[model samples]
Target chain A: GAGVSQSPSNKVTEKGKDVELRCDPISGHTALYWYRQSLGQGLEFLIYFQGNSAPDKSGLPSDRFSAERTGGSVSTLTIQRTQQEDSAVYLCASSRRQGEQPQHFGDGTRLSIL
Target chain B: AQTVTQSQPEMSVQEAETVTLSCTYDTSENNYYLFWYKQPPSRQMILVIRQEAYKQQNATENRFSVNFQKAAKSFSLKISDSQLGDTAMYFCAFMKHAHNDYKLSFGAGTTVTVRA
Candidate 1:
């Protein structure tokens, strides 16, 4: 793809339900990232995936938050037992090889936990 | 730990006028990168400009330019001839010089409204 692509642009789920957000990074991009942006807040680092190596999950806020990237292309962010506070926009970005290249971001998914 | 800060929560600029958004960051590492991202109401984050810490000269791309002060730990963005399309939330970001890694630390965004 020419740019990063995200799925489910808007999702409204009930509290305690599980939600999944998907991201398709640019072709040949090795580094994938997941970020959360709350209402009127900064982009919070969530997780980073660098190739087939072990993903850096240090930024996951809680056990309910988990993510996985397959074939180093598409990534999925899953939130189990979602709470109302989880209502926010989930963003995904990918860089060519990381380090120096600027990241390209997707349109993001607006999750509304009602 | 790297932290980016944008002091101004909101700013307004008339069309064709210039507006400067302030940003300050804290990083222990000497070699790093700074960036400015614009997120419009459409929910897409667009890269506005980027600067390398080692470079002394500023970076400019069309109507956007950055005032980078490495010694003072400051990186501010100056938007010349603001337009209505420029109305959006601007975020300042920081990333360190890690081999094949681009993890960014972002600041709370500033909402800029370009009035026509």
Candidate 2:
């Protein structure tokens, strides 16, 4: 793809319902990351996947939040039994490599938990 | 743990003028990276500029430049010839330079309103 792509640009769901947000990173990119942006807050790091290495999941807020990246390309973030506080924008980003390369971000999926 | 701070919650700048957004970060690591990202109403975070901690010279991109003070742990962005399109939420971010550390610590963004 030309740039990072996220699916379901907007989602509205009832509390306790599970929601999945998807991200397709740029072609040949070796690293992917997930972040959450709440209203009036900064970007919160969620998880990261680099090549074939073990993903860093230390930033996941709770056990209900989980993510997976398949074949180091497409990634999915799942929230189980979502709460009202989970209503925010979920963003995904990718870089050519890890360290010094600037990350390119997706438009993000705005999840509204009603 | 690294932290980035943008004390100013909001700022207004007249079009064609210059405005500087302040940022400060706390990190024990000697080598790291600092970045400024712009998010418009569309919610896409676009990289505006970046500075490498090891470089003594600041980074610049056209009308966007940075004042990086390593000793003071400050990295501020200066937008020259501001345009209406520059009105957006600007974020300052910090990341370690280690190959295994890629997480970006971001600050509470500064809302920049470039008015005509």
Listed for each candidate, the true contacts retained, as a fraction, are 0.85, 0.95
Task: Show how many residue pairs clash in every candidate, following the order shown.
Answer: 1, 0
Off by over 4 Å in 2: none
Candidate lDDT scores, in order, read 0.92, 0.95
- What's the DockQ of model 1? 0.78
Highest-lDDT candidate: 2
In candidate 1, list every pair of residues with a backbone clash.
Answer: A99-B101
TM-score against native, each model: 0.97, 0.98
Tens-place lDDT digits, model 1, residues B1-116: 78899999999999999999999999889899999999999888899999999999999999999999999999999999999999999999999887745688999999999999
Sorted into a CAPRI-style docking class, model 1 comes out as medium
Worst 10 residues of 1 chain B by lDDT: B95-104
